[model samples]
Target: MSSAGRVPQGLRRVYLNVRPERLGVLIGEGGKTLRDLENRTQTIVSVDSLNSSVVIEAATPETPIEMVLRASDFIKAIDAGFSPERALRLLDEDMVLIIINLKEVIGDSQSHLYRVKARVIGEEGKVRTNIEQLTGTYISVYDDLVAIIGDYEGAYLAREAIEMLIQGREHSTVYRFLNKKVRELKRKRLTEYWKKDFSTKEVKS
Candidate 1:
């Protein structure tokens, strides 16, 4: 048994719609991602498996502002839908996907496909990380699809860099510009990822 003050208190809730398939990724291994989000925003994030919705509970008055902001970020990503093209656009980069219908790249086994994906992701995810940091965008490469998420300027820069890479531009060149871009947007606000306040509680029917 716990004392009254020791018991946890409930906060305001904000709901989000998420695809069933991507739910696991959002939750992560052992709920790692969910826990990270909760710690960072100081909120309680509960997911309803049946409804495919997320409930965010603010820990305090201050928590509501941050919780809503973070919740909005997740909602936007979910609502925008998954498109390698759109993700790159969100990252402010122009990108092209070399669609290979088969699971493996020509002359290589499935393992080869993994290598190619790794090549795009780069060392310790440095390549993708640099792109996101510089352009203030998000880049995710899954299987044969490479998703880019950022604003216009970042997208433009990313597009040029990606095109150059596809055209056989040296990795060094692409990485250099990527670094520069990261510095540029370091303090920039990504409005596209921003969500308006949803702190108000839902009215009961």
Candidate 2:
């Protein structure tokens, strides 16, 4: 398809401007990640190196809206700072993407972005790793954006934790909050499991 054919017949396209430095990460080795994404989502993906823009289009009229949306989401996730591997999780029905724009919080004080991002990243990326492990999420602190990929429960808790950090809440306080949330999530998962098990047993009987 010609680059000028921006709008494929019976299909829609989503254009995203990716960071120049991160473009290689999005493209991956020899375009393997890009091809994998296209195959998984059944969408045509075109990356313009010079412009650092990506175009995602539905492969056919029969293609589901969800497929297109997921593909778009995956690209946006990469733009938002997530690795392509983590971004691919957007394809999962239960996984979600969340991006916190530092500009929203920093307003005109763009300089504050570096400090806030640093706090989330911690001394050696330990804080970020802790939050991911505690909340079962993947986090990426890139440029002026903080990106997260996880299931609904994990994403919600991780997002909250991240916001607290961005707000300059004490690190210890955030750690406690995450610990408490982790237990709550574990309990909820156990309850759901028991309910599902009971239903299965009843059906068997």
Candidate 3:
């Protein structure tokens, strides 16, 4: 199936592809995971294991298209190596999945891609762990793709750090950048919260 894009608003169907190996993860033991997804999104998910294709259809006319898209993203995230628990975060309104194609970044050369993946992953997963901690994002370095799941700001920050590492930046440098950005993000959020709270009080008065 071709990559899914925004469709006209309404109950609709979407198709996504999953790797054959990861189908079990998507299905879960006894189909619990897939059922949970369908329940949460109010959609029906059908899997074709032979084709590694998934079809998601809105369960009712009242079902929102956004929910359908969310299901699609949830599957894509898991297919990209995110654990089911981590992928579930996409159900949240603020959480998102950001994937970086290593081939697009460096090249199609397997060795080159492997080297870049190693840099993002670091030894013993220290770098990936640090990035996740610093940006509050969950990252997966799977095959030739690096997937990030988090709020938009955190996910973008994590992506930036990974890109820096891919560009041969020192690990320490990437960490510093994340640290600075994360602090700024916190302050911005605090400022926005107060502004919103003040406006609410003003209207109440």
TM-score of each: 0.40, 0.89, 0.92
Q: Please, what is the whole-model Cα lDDT of each candidate in the order they appear?
A: 0.56, 0.86, 0.91
lDDT of 2 by residue, 15-132 (tens): 8898888788888899898889889987899999899998888876655667878898898888887778788889998999888888887775766877898899999999999999
Task: State, as a TM-score between 0 and 1, how close model 2 is to the true structure.
Answer: 0.89
Task: Output the worst ten-in-a-row residue range by lDDT, candidate 2.
Answer: 1-10
Work out candidate 3's RMSD over C-alphas: 4.3
Q: Give per-residue CA lDDT, model 3, range 1-205, as digits (tens).
A: 4325434444388889898999999999999999999999989999999999999998876677778989999999988999999999999999989999888878889988888988888899998999999999999999778999999999998999998999999998888888889899999999999999999999999
- What lDDT, from 0 to 1, does candidate 2 have? 0.86
**Model 3: runs farther than 4 Å from truth?**
1-11
Q: Backbone clash tally for model 2?
A: 0
Would you list the rank order by TM-score, best first?
Answer: 3, 2, 1
Determine which window of 10 residues in candidate 3 has minimal summed lDDT.
2-11
In terms of lDDT, the best-performing candidate is 3
lDDT of 1 by residue, 85-153 (tens): 232222212322222222432334767656655656688988777666666666656544454555556
Q: Write down the lDDT that model 1 would get.
A: 0.56
